[model samples]
Target: MANKTYSFYPGCSSQNKASSSNYLVSTNSMCQKLGITLNEVPDWNCCGASIGYGGGGELPRIVLSARNLALSEQHNAGQDMVATCAACWLASREAKERLDHSPQMKADANEALKEAGLEYKGQAQARHMVEVLIEDIGYDALKAGVKKPLQGVKFAGYVGCQTNRPFGIAGESFENPLYLDNLVEAMGGEAVKSYDQKVTCCGGALAFSEPEKSQKQIKDIIESAYDHGADMIVTPCPLCQANVEIYQGEVNKRYGTKFNIPVTYYSQLITVAYGGTAAEAGLNGHVVAPAKLAEIAGK
Candidate 1:
């Protein structure tokens, strides 16, 4: 068991995004067992919530994530900051990149941080907790810690767009990403596939921006999974979870087809299958009942 501790930025989605909460809670539990404590950065705001960047203003991304980063810099100045939300991860990582490479941006960010009694010296590393677990904490070690093995369960790993996109700057491959799949496999479950739509969007805020398109996207993914025999769809995004779960009833009502695929956070499924309580991973809060998941586990 590793004793070194790392800080975490739960991001706004962690609370608003159901699956975000599930991933963070489970990751926290697992990290605790691994001698790693995921402490929250103080007074962090939304990572601009997808709308912060469109207007050509970097302040939202800079200040929001910088506040969190500055907190980590205070205690572990040169250490890495772990992000659970892909959006939050991107925002913070981008901010870190700007601060480290752009001197002018650093000056402005430091001015803003001064308001909160924090300073941004451009030394913190922004990383996905998934990366830390896989790269820093070897896979085999994670296997040894598994109290319950998910040997028979089949999982559909959904990485959503933000986790792996826009190529190199994103820190992971958009075309050949396998972190989620590998994490699932580490827990003793087989990460299954459905269709190309698996990597497609879950309509995100489209319910408000483009309801019809969002619905169609959600419909396509659900139907694709159904066609491909995916027992469940596991994702790391809260927005995707909301779009899929909140609109499942709407999809069913519209299509007259019963579509109730259990959409769970990767951490939630791993936590449950690894002999941890589903509630600990916040599975009960899922709009889609985990009955199918329970059934699979029973087998």
Candidate 2:
């Protein structure tokens, strides 16, 4: 396969030492195996996430992502802007849509961009990394790159809220997106097709503001995965992975239910399946380590 490249927009969570830094590491390993190059958009800023709307107001929130689009268009012209973080993709895509549809919003955003010595042409298309993996690089090509097939492993594909609702990956059902399931199967792992709560919200920023209510939602997500006999949970969203994996212990303590399921990104799974080591796959960064993947990589 010929090498493919895109302007990468790794959001705040995936930055160095950030909560989802491991996600970025595993993504690099996965792309290397797939022969993809991620040229980061120069001087990219935060996507403002979903929470940005409330705090920063409508225009500021839109401008935040518009700035990123402007930078990507300026630096990596013609390449699509890809983000691993679901929130980043959502926020950026939402900004582009708003600017393109509304002339006033576009004018206002461009005015703000002038302050940064930049302007929004609205040419860059924002996409989640999973879309690039599934759409740009098909499942057949993904399966062909597997050097270590995940034979006995079973994964519960968790799509979460942001990536599923409003504007999801093209050609996928919003309610039950099977792209994650297909990716798991492509990697030689069993996809828990029966696993429900795949589109359940992990409470996003609410997890920090309202722990009690959010933990309950997290409980349901992890519980469903276990009920489906999944060995681990896989997700495309960095927030979902962190919220689901990091909160298991707390959820267990609060609910008096022992839950220790390893939550991972699809990139990490692909990295392991592509013959990358545990470190390369960033498996060691897990709060609940995916011992199965570590064992596979060690072999």
Candidate 3:
């Protein structure tokens, strides 16, 4: 019933039961209540993510994202392409910007797309989910829509890397974004403003290449939230959620510390606070249980 129905690009994380499934699930559930609908782009491929950044091939990375743009333009025309994955948002936006900046580059990307019978004219806009929520749906409206305020629970709004660098949300400070904090306060939770690791990297896929170094970064990310009295960390990025949630226990063991902090998708919190269930929030996928969030929603 929402007037704003965005074309969704699920990216690699939420596909085939991957670690980010919970993010996608909670997103769909929350959007329904918010009067926003997401329509998935058919036959979408990887957004290249950090892997694309490592390739050092300009057109190839742009082309990977272009293919999705082209397909969405073809199928879901006139829509703003909304992505829950931060990497996908960055990749798609970069691809569009590169093409828009140069007609030759756009032509070249289209030529590469010819093999698949698709061509991107850059019709659809690339946007992260949080951008749409905060910009299109203001805090006043969001606060008014909340059925149950998340009281007593403290939260750290982690902004991670992809959505921060090059292009942050329209009106946020890149160095210290407060959209998440604003959202938490809108939902009646105490946002930890002093949590300084807001823009720190979570080691991404590097966790596999260098476990100790990655654990150290994850340690900083997790511990900073706890140090600030945050019961949980909420983010708009699936990669952040996966990296931080899946690694805290390992980091705690390595440093001989006790840390159990839940990294959650903002959509999950919205869904729960909007009178949706714990199951609807997709809390099951979290390695560190967001039981505090579930308990808050119960009231």
Query: How high is each candidate's TM-score?
Result: 0.88, 0.99, 0.97
Q: Between candidates 2 and 3, which one is better according to TM-score? A: 2
Local accuracy of candidate 2 as per-residue lDDT tens digits, 241-296: 99999988899899999999999999999999999999999998889989988999
Which consecutive 10 residues in model 3 have the weakest lDDT in total?
A: 48-57
- Total backbone clashes of candidate 2, pairs 3 or more residues apart or in separate chains: 0
Cα lDDT for residue 237, model 2? 95
Which rank order by TM-score, best down to worst? Answer: 2, 3, 1
Q: If both were scored by TM-score, which would come out higher, candidate 1 or candidate 3?
A: 3
Please tell me which model should have the higher TM-score, number 1 or number 2: 2
Candidate 2: where are CA atoms >4 Å away?
Answer: none
Taking all chains together, the TM-score of candidate 2 against the true structure is 0.99
lDDT of 3 at 229: 90
Name the candidate, 1 or 3, with the larger lDDT value. Answer: 3
Clashing pairs in 3: none
As for model 3, its CA RMSD to the true structure in angstroms is: 1.3
Q: Which ten residues in a row are the worst by lDDT in model 2?
A: 46-55
Full ranking by lDDT = 2, 3, 1
